[model samples]
Target: MGTLEGRLKGKVALITGAARGQGAAAARRFAAEGAKVMIADVNDAEGKALAGELGDPAAYAHLDVAEEDDWAQAVDRTVAEFGTLNVLVNNAGVLHFSPLGQTTLADYERVIRINQVGAFLGMRSVVEPMSTAGGGSIVNVSSVEGLAGMPFLVAYTASKFAIRGMTKVAALELGERGIRVNSLHPGMIDTQMVSDAAGGAEVDFSRVARRLALQRVGRPEEIADVALFLASDESSYCTGGEFVADGGATATHALKL
Candidate 1:
């Protein structure tokens, strides 16, 4: 009968790509739950606006995920602003649709650098502060594509799969240090990243939604709930695990029409 109040009270979090979409949703939830949040993203305007809207509970930081210096600065700012860093949600990523033969090395590396390498840097950067704070959680935002292959997504698949694997490795290595690492796999969430990747082309998710068991595309706020759980102590015993939030998309078999 008790309300879920202050679930993240006294906690501090840094979320990448938080200017909008799922990351932004998580930011709002974290703030409402009594956590200090840092909205880290390359989108300066939106990031700053979100931080302002969230008031003192949030701050904006410009972070180009693939850059080491940017990672360092973002981590430092989170600690300096919030007094400690207790959680990190590596939610920054770009989706690219390209055939295997046509996928450029440049494009492949770009996806890997942001989605894959960005998570790597985030985990590495937070260990020291999080350990000093006595413990923390790392939520790497992967995709259902990480679990299985999808057409025209070789690079994105590779990056998400790497995130899934790296999460396990980090969990094993960091458990003794009081840090928990896990991967979050979301399927077909309605977000701007897809449209942006398509060069502002209008996307029709109704067709895709029809194939889902839920028969609808996901919402960013939905995934934010899962991220909130993983970030909170509610998932204390849940490290090195895959937390999937797909709409039963993965439940189908190859023979499905």
Candidate 2:
């Protein structure tokens, strides 16, 4: 449905957290665009089911982004199955909400380990294989939280900020190798992550929308549209920069106004 649809014809991709949410949406979109996709996630049942639904035997792997060995093996398996690796979407992440005072070391550690370290490992693990396969693109799913602070999500915010910082450095370091690395700063989209962060709090979607220049929370597919562009050659000249797909959430000081 996007302009970049099918631009990745015959390319292969390995997407983490591909069982659901943004990851699942990206996987389906990538495959629809003619990329042989491997949906990797810790959720065995859902991951396997998604693979079946994609109807590609070699298109899924049980991956826990937190584990180094698992990350390496997933890339290996993907190469074995698909014969190449052209894209890596580091989409596996968890959102934990808590005020600074309520945030424990364990909670903070878990958040960073999954959200930040996971992407690092994914990039590191894929470098050699991707290099051998003649370079590739790495798309990291960061958050608008990385651009600004949100109350009660100290750990999540910190982790995403770290991802934003790391992504730039990774892009610079990998560019010479013919690989392009970019991070996506997604605005609050409709997904379970937002639901959990909202946590039954009294809120107004209308007010939230009015604050945005676009005046609305975006859909998962809307974010996927940007992902598709980044994944395909349409964005060939882009790297080491963030694509903010937020619905004008960061466009102005509307919240303060």
Candidate 3:
């Protein structure tokens, strides 16, 4: 695509959890597509390194998404560097896998605080700036687990579901202000988080592929592409909606006779 045709050109975006995984992938893609992005994460070393690699000022921040104060500072920093903020990608999250009985309160709180509350604070912090800028987009990174309950991962699943709900509510409340809010649901993907959650458990990747119509685990870029769509003017009319990029995992029938 021509540079002007780059859907995100001239947009200033802030993405949390950007040190690695899906967040980092989205940061790279956003920069490539012509958006000046603020890569926010608690991992200062990695975050700053990524910013250096992006080779731009205003490209990194030490943002702990679960902390409301950190969110405020990140927003301010982005505006101070980029001149304006047009997109907020609530991508920072934590995953703790355990059965309901085994899940600890501490783990649950950490997951929900980062995954759900972080998104909440991110929208709250950026909405005013976005409205003043004439409009903006907020993309919350949800999960397929939000759509269906899994055997393990009670805390992780809970947080994702909460995000999905909050995304819809925020969308409705922010739409009149010209700000759009939406959630992106990703299914099983090849990432360090997933591998860590798997924890050496014997699982068949091919089996997972066969379960989904696409017959494959998704890539970070696959989900990032959806975020890009929701963050840009291309999806100008979309808001308060759930974008399921789960490779048809949710569409399959439960009963396979």
- TM-score to native of every candidate shown: 0.98, 0.93, 0.94
lDDT of 2: 0.86
Residues 1-257, model 3: lDDT tens digits: 32446779889999999988899989988888889999999989988999999887347889988888898899999999999999999998877778899888888898888888888999999988999899999999999888888877888888899899998899889999999999999998777776666685655688788788887989998888889899989899999899998898888667843
User: Between candidates 2 and 3, which one is better according to lDDT?
Assistant: 3
Best by TM-score: 1
Q: lDDT of each structure?
A: 0.95, 0.86, 0.88
Question: Any runs in candidate 1 off by more than 4 Å, and if so which?
Answer: none
Pairs clashing in candidate 3?
none
Instruction: Order the candidate numbers by lDDT, best to worst.
Output: 1, 3, 2
Candidate 1 weakest lDDT stretch, 10 residues: 1-10
Q: How big is the positional error of residue 137 in model 2, measured in Å on the Cα after superposition?
A: 0.3
For 74-94, candidate 1 gives per-residue lDDT tens digits of 999889888999999999999
Misplaced by over 4 Å in model 2 are 3-5, 197-204
- The deviation in Å at residue 97 for candidate 1 is 0.5
